[model samples]
Target: MKFLSAAALAAGLCLGLGATQAQAAQKALLIGAGEYPYLPPKAQLSGPANDVRAMTQFLEGYWGFSKSDIRILVDGDASKQKILNAIQSWLPGATQPGDRVIIYYSGHGSQIPDTSGDEEDGKDETFVPTDFGRNGDQASDMLSDDEIGRALNMLKGREVILIADSCHSGTINRDIVPGLAKDGIDARPRYLPFSGSSTFFADARDVEPLAREVDTHLNLSAALPHQLAWETNGSGIFTQTLIQGLSSGQADQNGNGRITTAELLNFMRPKTEAWCQGVEQCRELQFTPNVSPRNEAFVLQPVRPAEPVQTVTGDSSEDVSDVLPERERDKIAVRILPGAMHEIGDEVQFQLTSELDGYLTLLDLTAEGKLVLLFPTDEDRAAGKTGKIRANSTLTVPDPSYGFSFVAEAPAGNGKLLAIVTQDRVDLEDLLAANGTFEPIDDKMGFIKEISGRLNTVWTGDTTNRSVSWAAGYKEYEIRP
Candidate 1:
């Protein structure tokens, strides 16, 4: 029955902003379960409770939520029945039309066999309750995304936000050493049935239907579907950045004295990535916040108007030939055709043609900020097929037979593709080694840095005969339901 202490709640309640005209109440149900009494001791965490506590304070102080309107559930108190009652009965019943409802859960997340067969991935993402059991029957106790979606369907509120700072996968051993005694503690949430498999897939379609019911439904997840969400000290990194972004008004990107759902995500995505890189344990761990907003954009908070600034502009066209040493301008020409937005499921054929004969490399930066090497895959490398394009020749990516094409995924955003043409063959063994043999690098900045370093080492000091050039194209699209 351990909850946020009365004194702590009082402190959160006492902090408030200037009152406005009477409006619909803003209610929040903050659930943080760090202790699993029914599970192993190694599965216990110390960050969830703190996460809820911090969010509670932020909601009360800046978001205009009264102490009475916010419900805090922590650790042992977040049992299956209590959680279901709060979401199903308490939240939906308490809120009227136009009210803003926020449901934040900071805990372990797992997956179970999809008995309903609705999931294409054959699994269902679930939230691990405090009473989660190790027995096979524990699936009944775990809360599935469908159940939450059903509860959300009953809510009368127009603005509903779901923030989950937990990963839906199982244990991951991040130990760097080999053959060392390892603790069974997983940085992620506990898995049911104690199965060794940690593979889990979270599809946006599972909740997209219920989300469309509301006027504005914003779902902010700490990590991508199959990625791990890391915690340090006593709080999740995403929650920490969220609190800071709201409190400091750093998320107000437009400087319009308000923070929108989209603005908050744009502000937090890079900050979370940068912060994760600094953490020793989270360096290799990719933390990409998935922001899915249904319908129209909604304002998250109001801030003081930003100070006005002066405008400055440089010459529209400046010749870089004078600044370059004649070898840096352009020796190889590259082009990507059909540069425009595309449908989610459409097969995107990217055609690259080079004016000079050289090796080609294709890299993609997904909307979620994931860096993937599209060309010269491991298989291609094993086959000794150098990514060479003959002079004035065209190279179609994926070969159509390899079943390779760019298909947009859910939570749509912008994606960029880069084509690098090098006079000499480029070896990726060093890059692969640096990335721990992972195809796509986990950290964006790390990827950029590694690629830049490799390019420098390849093209620098002796470019009299070898010339390297790169061209990039981007696509902005929507993922239709």
Candidate 2:
């Protein structure tokens, strides 16, 4: 695996800082090294190496870091001193008072004795180097989380991000002994007074004998399994989801153009361990975001509707006869009064509106199942932004300030138009709870008595018990024809 040094990062940040203070630099040290060739062959180390390479490409290509601005270090037999030295050297001076820094590690991680004797659990979370040792005397080889934390804290900045793609092994390992080599054990150890053999915290080994130290590491130990889980594909499950969220723009729930460190962590931590049911097995990814808080809650609008998957069996040439434009026209000007329905869309204008920040995509329900953009051609799209329609600001209420439009010639016949919004559905009840109004309408554009199954209705506006009337506020609207 390869790791990027901080010096290269500093150079890039220095250039980008310009008038801005050199306080925070977007820096990352990607380390992917499995104890290969030397240690017994573990899960093929191929997964992590590929993942690290892909990460490097993302950082430099999409993230816009000059190749020279990043450092890459891989250790097959690299020593702990060597790894620490490189970390200290990578992104030299990458942190400033309020600056942000990111550290990504993809390899084997473990919890070891907190030789400092300050931890109540007697165990400190540690990241294994290519040359980790099982010997109690090999102090120089172990990399403790606190040690790294202190080193990172040395920076002028307080906010630091550390991603460990390794799972914590609680010391309850009945299979493998810590001082002695052993593996495989289930069940939490009994909580007891600290033993001389115990390193940091009293229950440090209570979780397991050699279980990944995810439980007690980085102040996340209080949360148990939510703290440390397994890291597959060289990236922890949470880390993988985090990267996807960044790309999907889900981390930016507020629809902001950029993703801050805090955004990534907030979106990833829970999603990472949601699968674990028991407290004993649940793991968490901890973020020590010091200095300024990072709001990664930016919204990402979709570029186009997600295309549907189709399995083609035979020849590509099939239908061409049904492609005829409608001859008879029943035109109706569809308009929602200002603040009436927030947003609207159909064959002509597939506009989408959402209280939560997400993308709007239009899948052609015209039987072709084609994915297309839902918005009209009038709006301007920002970088990393997708979705057919979106709000101008998250702080803004359901006051209909944002909308989009689209137009397409429909085929002749009684074809139904279907579309979906790419965001979490909001509760209409809550919107109504805040004094939202909903009224049923009759053909005469007057209030109706009741609504059900299907209405022989025509032109129902804002004041209708019609299904369209429920689209008052705080929810994404889907238009069907």
What clash pairs does model 1 have? none
Worst 10-residue lDDT window for candidate 1 reads 1-10
Estimate candidate 2's alpha-carbon lDDT, on a 0 to 1 scale.
0.35
Root-mean-square deviation of every model: 22.9, 19.6
Best-fitting candidate, scored by lDDT = 1
Superposed model 1: Cα runs more than 4 Å off: 1-22, 134-137, 169-216, 279-281, 294-296, 302-481
Candidate 1 global Cα RMSD: 22.9
lDDT of each: 0.56, 0.35
TM-score of each: 0.51, 0.43
Write the residue-wise lDDT of candidate 2 on 1-481 in tens digits. 0000011111221122111212224555667665444344432243345446666776665554546545555556345666566556554555333333445565655555667776556666566666654343254455676667555535422233455555454533322221111243221211111122434332333332222321111121112322344443243444456557766777775453445445655666567445333233332333221111112221111111123211222111111101101110111111222322221222232223444344332212222222122221123232223332343332211123444223223322112221223233222222122221111111211111011101111112322111111111111222223
Would you give me the overall lDDT of model 1?
0.56
Write model 1 residue lDDT over 1-481, tens digit each, in one string.
Answer: 0000001111111111011112345678999988888765667777899899899878767665668888988988888789889987888778754456788989877766667777666666778888877454457788877777677766633356788887754333422111112253233322223243454333433332222222225677787654567666677878999889878988887675557667788888898788656544555545677766432244564211122211211211111112222232344433333444544455555667665567776665444435666676665665566677886777886565655555544544434455666655545556644443224566654554444434322122231211124322222223332
